[model samples]
Target chain A: MSTALAPARTGSDERLTGFAGEPLDQRRYRRMRFIRRFEETLLQLFEEGALNGTTHACIGQEADAVAVIEHLAEGDHIFSNHRCHGHYLAHSGDALGLLAEIMGKEAGVCRGMGGSQHICAPGFKSNGVQGGIVPNAAGIALANQLSGNDAVSVVFIGDGTLGEGVVYETLNMAALWKLPLLVVCEDNRWAQSTPIAANLAGDMAARFAAFGVPVREVDSTDVEELSAIAGEEVGLVRAGAGPRVLLIHTYRLCHHSKSDDERPEREIADRWLVEPLLVHGQRLDEADRRRIDDEVETALGEVVATARALP
Target chain B: MIFAKELGDTLRGALTDDPRVVLLGEDIADPYGGAFKVTRGLSTAFPQRVRTTPISEGAIAGVSAGLALAGYRPIAEVMFGDFLTLMFDQVVNHIAKYQAMYAGQATCPVVVRAATGGHRGYGPTHSQSLEKHFLGVPHLRVVAASLFHDPREVFSDFLGRDEPVLYVEHKLLYPQHLTLPVNGRIGDLLATSEGGPLPTVRLSAVPVEDCTVSVLAYGYQAMLAAKVIERLAMEEEIFAELLVPAQIAPMDWAPVERSVAVTGRLVTVEEGADGWSWGTEAASVISRRLFGRLRRPVDVVASEATVIPSSKTKEASILVGSAQIEAAIRAAAR
Candidate 1:
């Protein structure tokens, strides 16, 4: 498992200390790197035929998973769909267990029952199908409401997932019930091969607004800005304001999967120019950047060795 | 005939007693009391937990799965049995598979209550019995209660369990008063009638020694089967033992196997269509597990494979009757 944003038991750094109740930007930075490294490792394992099934790598969508999830408390549940490696790594931080699951090992989080597509643990659950997790996530929110707990439920869906009818059905119910839910839709331009523009009709804002849910969308590639907006929105839901939707306009640099290379070369080339890591790193001082880079490198090296040594 | 209101009272009792039990379905709320009135006064009694969802069958059942995972035992009622098809994917894929698939990481303690069977003139969509569609799903408990059995106990029992259960009810069985022996498999009713709890009620047609065949049944068919047993005792003096399995999936086969073991003949009855019904499963169990003890081939009484027509005559022709049970028993005995 990658200890990216580990529990407070770890010793604090002297130069850039993240003490109790402090904003952990450095920690989230490492978490994103961990997800990036984990997905890269998954690709290599897939190439070597070490993994059983094909994985929908969230390589470029790391910022969307981290920025939103970073605001949630430990007890808050996250329901995930196909492209969920980043979400699992962000929430559970169990990269090795995820790798073990990809390899079909009994020691995996779901006991080798659920692989990359179907990963679930304590406080986190996922399924393979798009639009499948949203309804259940609403139920989890209802559970929180019934139990009188302030905990919120978040579901990670994509722009293309709106093509599924159940998402609208679930949205209507969630809004009607006044359940505490945060619906995060990562719009990465393309939906596998087909673009979201071709299938989805109607104004996105009006669709959710009519359901009585507050909708917010960020077109920026900056992770910190995304995090700040999400934190405020999460606070609103936590304060009994009902469900909210965070529509993130991000881009995926990697192919949808290992087999996917049908995307236009020019389109892929343009997207790489404004990818997250380089742009996001320029904000921090050179010393802080190097520190995070060194920590992430050491963690990735150890993560690879631990994943390979398991079986 | 035992009326179905007693069953309603039983469900009401569970809600009143336990805080975790919540009744959800179409028109289950005040003034409506459910389409069949099975959940009458439940919303009035427990308003917070009980709710009338917006006819979204898939989401209603899907939400129940979430509610169960979150700790409350959600009783999701699909007004008619046919609508359960809309949510069958959630029932079969998520609710049933969650506990087993996630290795206990998730549990769906949901009891899906539906009115199933074809005696009413409601047509193919509204009146068909589709329990067979979900008969063999793993980790899902299939229970169909008749008037003779304790509907209260059935709801309370499955409500307390950790896994998901599909509890099927027949519309006609509701207005009828239930009648069955307290204890024993087939003929041991007199012995078990003395004392103790009856989880697996096997009302005897006659004493074990006098019994000619063991009739295995559940749901509404239990009444038809009981009628046949009564007539067989009076007209032919050919006694047959009846086995009403309260729990269908992972069936309580001990008393059933014992009944067939003594009687040397076995017959299974169900309201679902003939192909791949619970009766087929019972017949298979008898042939494979108790073949040596059987004196003849096992018989199954089930509705024929066809759409349930709206006309009264057409409906009667398709559904199994006491006459069918009687014939099956006579053939098994011979």
Candidate 2:
């Protein structure tokens, strides 16, 4: 796993990269791009006073969702945090339900009850409580292991969630019980308004390693590499190698929620240069990228239209 | 059968009856058999399903929620009811809200069993009736074990249900015999039961007529109230009805209503510290429903609002015992 914070090489040089001997699918790019546009559209709706409550968009962290979800099997479950739109879309592909849910429509996934932070679809669940879902994910893995099913449980948490103590308690149990759990810690370097340095003490990787759970760290914004690492980690967990962690050191491109970005403007601009979409989008042909973007725009437009028209 | 043995047998029956039933707790496995021995010999009978978890109440609850979501009926033990505060977020924020928040996309058929109540001298933290804190939490059922209510029926019913339940087992009642109502009578009190899943039993004197006051309680306090009512009828010639609702949360007001309607006065008894308690809610609800019919304001007999001490005499004074219930009933009837 690469530890360098510099942007990975993109464009034609990375066009043919694959994980597990399978060529990189264009659908990955399409999914990542769709999540990006969907959340960006949510922000637009938030500004227009069309949405209720708050939303934590995974604008720059789309690669993590798209990549990690690719390795999940049908029975495998994904437990996500507040910033769960990307994970929900990548896992269940129910954008309309999610969109309608955020709009508080009756046809929403959770019948509009979950809203933005809480979403529940089959094999996919998300909650806004930081680090609270870690044990839940471990529990699913425990069930699968007990039932003799090879299903893996994957949970996505932000760097800020590490401040919660339950996460460590879960890690202790997951490692001790040999539960097939893959913990994807998306270290976006910021916990709401506070930076990682201010919120977290000691090392993130060492935290998991202390419980004897293996850690696979990635620092690049490239979806291909992230998918590769996620695949290996998920495969190992499924193969009964106990619980593992994939600490993706990335940056949140958007505000924490709605216009709460207190970071330096120069820092935001610097992160934008190496955003996941740009890195992965550069690898796709111009026409292919344009086609995917157009499809995402149309799909998102239809979702918004349908959600707004809901009674 | 003893209360703990009946609970253990009920759990064993549940484990034998369903493969989906899994037990999670600290020291609940054979040998250790939980702090109260309610789960004794379960892990030995069903080793695969009976899992002894680390002392992590939050994880025990979260894991149980996860299992329930995956189509398993999990019974998680929180060792002591006071430690339920540790699992508060998981129960209130996650387990309780999953079904409603998910809009029926999920159902958590998890039963968290915590041994509750004082009189054991475990001091401030261990000996507490914290079920009051969890009452009225949406989608969460709070059921207490009583000598009148069979543990087998309760666990079996929980296995068939989808909602989460906080099963409160009073510590003092563990060794006591389960003297169930025979021919609608337990000892000198005639038991008229109402409701289902969790029944509310109305116990009165045998020739049951013209009860002066209705004493409402649950769990061990209900037993204490039974003793008080029987003694009141036998010694003082003061007849009072004891209304014990096995299920506290989403309380079945039917029995209370019936008893209060006849007696025209009500007194709620509980072991929890005073203020914002189950008794308070019962009093308020019953008072509202039977406003004109009641003869006087409903009385709430609960523990003194203070930390429970380890000293037996101090704990006795701080806790609600038979004396308090008898005194309150005498006053309410007067």
Which numbered prediction scores highest in lDDT against the true structure?
Answer: 2
Tens-digit lDDT string for candidate 1 (A1-311):
12123343233231222335544666556566667777887898799887887888887788888787777776788999889888887776676677788788887888788888788787888887667578888888988888888888999998888777667778888888899999998888778877767867887666778888999988866778888888877888877899999988888777787778677789878777666666576766778768777766676667567766776
Off by over 4 Å in 2: A1-25, B206-208
- Report how closely model 1 matches the true complex, as a DockQ value: 0.66
Candidate 2, residues A276-296, lDDT tens digits: the string is 989988888888778767777
Cα lDDT of model 1 by residue, B1-334, tens digit: 2455887787788877877777778888988888888777878878878888887887888788888888888888889998888888788878888887787888889899888887889989998789888878998988887755666656767766797888888888878776644433333233222212225556654676789898888878887887778777778877888777767776767888887889988888887888777888888887899867788888888888888889999888988877788888888877
Model 2: share of true interface contacts reproduced:
0.67
Q: Candidate 2 has what TM-score?
A: 0.95
What C-alpha RMSD does candidate 1 show over the true interface residues after superposing them? 1.2
Candidate 1 lDDT score at position A268: 77
Residue-level error in angstroms, candidate 1, position B204: 2.7
Q: What are the iRMS values of all candidates?
A: 1.2, 0.9
**Which regions of candidate 1 deviate over 4 angstroms?**
A1-25, B1-3, B180-198
The models' CA-based lDDT, in order, is 0.78, 0.86
